[model samples]
Target: MQYWRKPLDADKIQVPHGEIHIVRDRCKGCGFCVEYCPRDVLELSKQFNIKGYHPPEAVLPEACVHCQLCEMLCPEFAIFVTLREEVETIES
Candidate 1:
């Protein structure tokens, strides 16, 4: 089965800078998000969250491409990706 490769227009396929979010309380520490993120943006840590499990961390925020695949694959739905506002450049 063929799949969408993300639209190409700058408006629809914008490569916006983005960030990752981890819901500390809801994470189950199953490592599902850590393993599935294509960009390898997440990592398992020795530190634990309020729920007592070692929640996933955004170890490499710069590596994220805002694909949202990890967020969709997470069983607990505790992960989210937020796009940062583009910094408009001024040309002299």
Candidate 2:
């Protein structure tokens, strides 16, 4: 089985279609989520979690493209992403 794959182009991915959820307590301040986020959506928060580690925050909420890099790369299972359904447009 192929275990490695090329990273997607963030510019080609649609934006404003998703959101990320942070499991603060589960995070260990590993920074993988922030580092691998394709759209630079996440950042380390100044505030600490109950574990006394700085969890990542969705700093650029509008830029998120539901690429799931943050969710996949996080060893601590701290963050996850959800994609919004596309709104259909009706032609007049």
Candidate 3:
């Protein structure tokens, strides 16, 4: 949750903007992200996968707080969160 508010240096990290990759086959739909994420970006899908379990879906990209808890907690390692600078506005 706190990481979302922190700014990352471009030289340190280079990743895509607001991109969260979720693999359906790998997801177990445990809803751990749903429980851990403060921003509530992930949600349980109604449809079931081949494994007979509902996978987690990124319903809102903007709502992601970039906490990385989803990535850490995922037992199947199905989620990826990449951070990138969307703008170059100087804050005073």
The local distance difference test score of each candidate is 0.75, 0.76, 0.73
Model 2 RMSD to the real structure?
Answer: 8.6
lDDT of 3: 0.73
| Candidate 1 lDDT tens digits, 1-92 | 12255334434433445588888788889998888887777899888888899888888886677788878888888888888776322220
Model 1 residue 71 distance off true place after TM-score fit, in angstroms: 1.1
Task: Residues 15-73, candidate 3: write the lDDT tens digits.
Answer: 33456888888888888887787677888989998899999888888656456888889
Q: Over the stretch 1-92, how does candidate 2's per-residue lDDT look in tens digits?
A: 11155335533543345778999989999998888777778899999899899999988986676778888888887788888775222220
Error of 1 at 24 (Å): 0.9
- Candidate 1 lDDT score at position 82: 89
lDDT value, residue 36 of candidate 1: 86
Off by over 4 Å in 3: 1-17, 87-92
Query: In model 1, how large is the Cα lDDT of residue 67?
Result: 81
Query: Model 2, residue 20: displacement in angstroms?
Result: 0.5
Clashing pairs in 1: none
Give me the overall lDDT of model 2. 0.76
Ranking of all candidate structures by their TM-score, best first: 2, 1, 3
